[model samples]
Target: MVERKTIFSYLPHLILLIGIAVVAFPVYVAFVASTWDPATISNGQMPLRPGPHFLENYYQTIFVGTSRTTREPVGGMMFNSLVMALTIAIGKIAISIISAFAIVYFRFPFRMTAFWVIFVTLMLPVEVRIYPTYKIVSDLGLLDSYAGLTIPLIASATATLLFRQFFMTVPDELVEASKIDGAGPMQFFRDTLLPLSITSIAALFVIQFIYGWNQYLWPLLITTRDSMQTIVIGIKKMIVTQDALTEWQIAMATAVLAMLPPVLVVILMQRLFVKGLVETEK
Candidate 1:
């Protein structure tokens, strides 16, 4: 028998649509503003509809550098952000997966202690340890470098915990099967575990990538050169405190461009991401 539809059944969908509208309206305004001229935006005459300067504004934002605060083109900053994000995402996955594998499979001295230590670091985020971390990077002359941008932030306790929890759920029969098939630890990890963990890896990569891309404070502290800035910092720089001089159109364009990569990653990985979070059996 078919279920009957009711007004109450539609409530959740209506609420979700309202939430989407609330979130999407500002983004729509930003996109509209990006298509407008600086004068139109600064004078508060920008229409709700898309403007005519879309191509010009985006071309200037991507290629020709903004005038006031950041002279570096948005493209360069996007490149920097891309490098940082990819490095952080890959590095976190590799290190966290290896650590989790070892913790779950290997018998070593102080294994639980090591795991606890890593877990404890979740409390001490980058903000809390910024001063010393900055000093060390500065002393090592890694300032304004890709290494400086990514290395310090790559050791992820959250990812490690996630991988560890997933690994713990693996059946003992699989380990025995691997042993019977003459699979060494590395072989097992490479051939068996890696394939099994793909969805989780995809999910974590999306998260870490966004985390790295949107980094502001740490990049701000470490990087002085315009070439080393991320998209997030570039957007901040474009919007000057002086409203008249700020390139509102270019800034809006940069903001819109900055959102694209993360959105694409989420869209592409949507299936694996959802599975990684919810799936249990191998």
Candidate 2:
């Protein structure tokens, strides 16, 4: 038998429900607005209830796009976003893990100094370094390319630190046992270390993917061609005009679509992310 809850016990649940509604109200309104005609939303009298044009609005946003301000389809933009996001995530993980492995396993002079220098980068915001980074990317002839979009953002100090901390937790006994079995350091790392690092890699991948996908300023400045535009950056072009003729329905639909990938990533990987975080901290 279950014990009945008193009114005071329900207070916390009530508060949480209220909080969820407060945050979700704007998204609900956007979803509602996306189902209305441009004229309906343009009048600012859009209904609270679901309108009949939801499917058409989404279809146009994905395939046809809001062409008044931008001609590129949202489908292409989403593809570009996915590419950038995955590239950043993979690049960060690859480099960070290697750097951490080198730092933890090898005893080189000035190793701590090198580690500190890399760690110091965490304090610097991307905005602070954008001008120099832009100049370098321009000089390298990488502008308007995927490399320009993802490379400059791939050096992740947080991921490196996380991996370094995790590496320190691996037992010295494992190294001894592997050596006794005639396994080289590289061979041991390939089999033992990588397997143990899976949860951390998954968690970091999610973080870096979100970071790359949501990048607006850098992509906006670097990408001159419409074909290179990311969904986050391209959405701005859709709202350039404040007039009633602007496609609010299409814009709202696109906004909803833009939010789906990151949300789904977190929801799908919730268990892995939690485990990775907890273990990493330990």
Candidate 3:
């Protein structure tokens, strides 16, 4: 007789299957909606079928045919999103690595207190601090600037803390051996520490990249000019316009477009990220 699976093993798979469906349903609906016409969407049509207008909608959304101020093309929007996300990711890595190295390897007075101050920012999310952050951005003459948008979120306390924790696992003998061979702090970090922490760094890179890519509310609040608008802002602008009704098809299309980068990044890096986690256990 065939053996039946136990509830314990089967239950987790059931939950995961449900979760996957829940997450994928919206994306599938959006794709289907993007292919349909605005009239069909407005008329409460169900099971939206792919129409011939799919290419037309995509073309109009992505490329410019007329005026510059009429709403950004999908290409420009995607480019802006790519640049911002990459900038944030690179900045986060540079800043966090230094911060992690300092906290993990160096000893100084009131160091714990300093780390805590940064950590506390995590508790009060960007939402809570928007008023003050906006003011600070304005006062610094950085409003609508890439520096203002990117710099505020450049350093992540969470990345530093996690890296520090992982770094603690590295053998002190390695540092001592390097020092005995006449390596300095910078050399040791670059030649020894970083090489050993690739997994942790890869893991952090994926996480931070996603976090930066998905940032919407902060970008919306900060960027005023159309030129400064990122993909998320462009998507929002397409959905609700002061002059006309919401264009549901284009909005969904824009969303689907915006999602590609992060999704592709994760898919490409999933192996490294997972391998990093596996190595972390050892």
Candidate 4:
């Protein structure tokens, strides 16, 4: 019976391991390809060992030659991406927390209907509004600028919804006690609610940060010039050469680079994320 119980406990873990590998195999292939020369990739040869050319591919993508002229470097494009992503992440978190707190804790008119309407926006993806959004950005003279890319996405339904749901799990009794002790709404939130909701906030942060970081269509549509482009956009361009034969190696290398920042953020926040969720249940 003990042995049978042990098998049952391990079954789910074994399945998850298989699932992770299935999802990760393509990423592994891309990383391996990035370490090889384009010539080897084009010839359909699989990488047997890591080659010295990976750094060469990375350096070429990030820097211009000695007699450089007429283009921004890949590293500069990546910096733009980082700035945009960080801006959106911070702004979205602030807005979502405020909106969620208001809806959950404060009394307001048409609040339920307004919240539902905003939640519906999640159904309509950016692709559906591409042309109209482009025209609006251009009309506002925000095209090819960071403002165009970051401002429109500062409000997100998913974040607000997640935060609201989490906030509801917070006890009204604790909030009432704070109020009795002379805590105003803002004071109540700052002193009690926000501290308790840290885990849910961390989880939401990871999800929203990844969403902003991986955003492609809206940024690409708004920014036409290479100088204003993000890392993902530049990587997309790098994949296709002058004659349109894809440079698979360099493209893979850029992809690997772009994926690293978010992965690191998630890994760092994972402990807080688990703890937060556990606290929410209490």
- Index of the highest-TM-score prediction: 2
Comparing 1 and 3 by TM-score, which wins? 1
**lDDT measured at residue 117 in model 1 versus the true structure, 0 to 100:** 88
Model 2 TM-score, 2 decimals? 0.93
What are the clash counts of all predictions, listed in order? Answer: 0, 0, 0, 1
lDDT of 2 by residue, 1-282 (tens): 275777678888999999999999999998998899888888789889989998888889899888678977899999999999999989999999999998999899999998998889888877888888889999999999999999888887888889999889899998889899999879988988999988788888877777788998899889999999999988888886567557888888888889999878878988866665565444
For candidate 1, the 10 contiguous residues with the lowest summed lDDT are 273-282
Model 2: residues with Cα > 4 Å off, grouped in runs: 1-5, 274-282
User: What are the TM-scores, per candidate, against the unseen true structure?
Assistant: 0.92, 0.93, 0.85, 0.81
State the lDDT at 80 in candidate 3. 70
Minimum summed lDDT over a 10-residue window in model 2 is located at: 273-282
Per-residue lDDT of candidate 3, residues 24-92 (tens digit): 989988888888877888878746466667897788778851122336677876777777788887898
Return the candidate ranking by TM-score, descending.
Answer: 2, 1, 3, 4
Clash list (residue pairs), candidate 3 = none
Give residue 19's error in model 3 in angstroms: 5.3
Model 4 lDDT per residue over 98-169, tens place? 998999987889999879987898888878888987898899999989999999888778778777888888
Residue 276 in candidate 3, Cα distance off native in Å: 8.2
Instruction: Report the CA-based lDDT of candidate 3 relative to the real structure.
Output: 0.78
